[model samples]
Target: MKAVVFSRYGGPEVLEVRDVPEPKLGPESVLVDVRTVSVNPVDWQIAAGHLDSRFDVRFPVIPGWDVAGVVAEIGPTVTEFAVGDEVIGYVREDSIGRGTYAERVAAPLRTVARKPMNLGWEQAAAMPIAGLTAYQSLVRTLRVGPGDTVLIQAAAGGVGSFAVQIAVAMGARVIGSASDRNHDYLRQIGAEPVAYGPGLNECVRALTPQGVTAILDMYGGQTLTSSLDLLSDESKGRVVSLTNDGILEQGGTFVFARPSKADLDQLTRMAESGVLTPEISTVMDVTDAAEAFRLSQTGHVRGKIVLRVMGRLSAAIH
Candidate 1:
């Protein structure tokens, strides 16, 4: 199998494309013939060694988590899927040694589900990590509900795009922050776009004068702190950050959306039905995966970046 592997954590230049032995499938795993894999900030973060504490990577790591592929073989214990069944999911960060930046990967059954029938391989690959995180943060952690007003930072980005759509589908009035260029796209996806700038707090307040019921801060540093101050009552507003800045404040909640098979299944359904759609900024060859990592680190991507692993599946939903 040809894979993008890095012997050590440093920069994108450290990544190299090489022929590596195929992964060994476990009793509870399925071998996926990878078609596409999306790039997330976590991918680059791990490659740059920023998440060393959270995940200890074995040397020569393949750096991708989101995978969309067909089951080439099934584990002895796996009964949910069979060979040729299309699936998508995020790989365990600790299991980067068997990562998705390759022609094929063996992933635990618990982390994967059948790919949405309405999504292409690229779109399916884009959903797992980012979409699940947004869904969990809003629906599970923040408890956003109908008649609620929710603000999502970086709305044009990967997680933000899904958050906006999912929140709207849940009947919450959503306000999203992005640059001027993304505002139109965000609006089309059912979010009231707010151009983030000098006084983004006031901008949010102006849009939802009654005050936001919840805020999911994908941009943590200043965006989150400002969101905290915009709350009319702390109880009505729940702020959740993907960052570990400790800014949830007294009587508030901070969440790191943990991966869950159940959550991925829900996201997959929402995507297939068109209630949620993933925005992909670019697609690169597997060999150019290192460049994809660099793009993700810039933090300016309007949507998800994906690595092309193989030909699109004819049966894949598009």
Candidate 2:
């Protein structure tokens, strides 16, 4: 199998293409011919060794979490899936051992979900991590509901786009923060967009004089701190973050995305029904994965950046 792997962590330069052994299938695993995979901030963060203390990944790791493909072979114990089933899901962190920047990956049964038949591979690949984070952030951690006011930071980002749409579909009044360039785009997606620049907190205050009912902070640093101050005293106002999990004592929930087959399955169904959609910025070949990782780390991506795996999978969604 051809893959992009690196023995060390540093920069995009460290990622290299190589011919590697195919992953050995487990009794409960399915061998997928990966047609598409997307890059996330976690990919670059893990690659740069920023998560070494937490994830504890060994050297020579292949970095990717979101995968979409056809099941080429099913394990003996697998019953829900069969050969030629189209699937998509967030691979468990433990399976980061083999990685997804390759032609094939053997994914555990619990982590995989049926892909939406109507959606293309690029969109399916982009949905897992980003979509799950958005779903869990609003529906699980924050409990967003009708008439609620939600302020989503980085509203034009990978997770942020999903958060905005899901909050709107739930009947919540959504306020999104992003740079001026994305303001119009955010508004088109059912969010009341706010310019995220100097005095961003003041801008948000001006938008909602009653104070926001909830906040989904996908960006850490000052963005998280700003959200902590913008919450109303009522318990209805809570802050949920995917990038930060520290210093929240003011009745706000701190959150991190955990992969779940049930959540992925629900999200895929939503995508197929057109209740939710994955926004894809660009799609590139796996051999150009370094470029995809570079684009993801910029923090300015309007949506997900996907990598189209080759050879083992068919030619699609390039």
- Per TM-score, the best of the predicted structures is 2
Deviating ranges (above 4 Å) for candidate 2: 248-251, 312-318
Backbone atom clashes (below 3 Å) for every candidate:
1, 0
lDDT of each: 0.82, 0.83
What is the TM-score (0 to 1) of candidate 1? 0.93
Model 1: lDDT of residue 261? 82
Lowest lDDT 10-residue stretch of candidate 2: 309-318
Summed over model 1, clashes come to: 1
Cα lDDT of model 2 by residue, 76-123, tens digit: 999999999999978865534578887888898888999998899999
Native-referenced Cα lDDT, model 2: 0.83
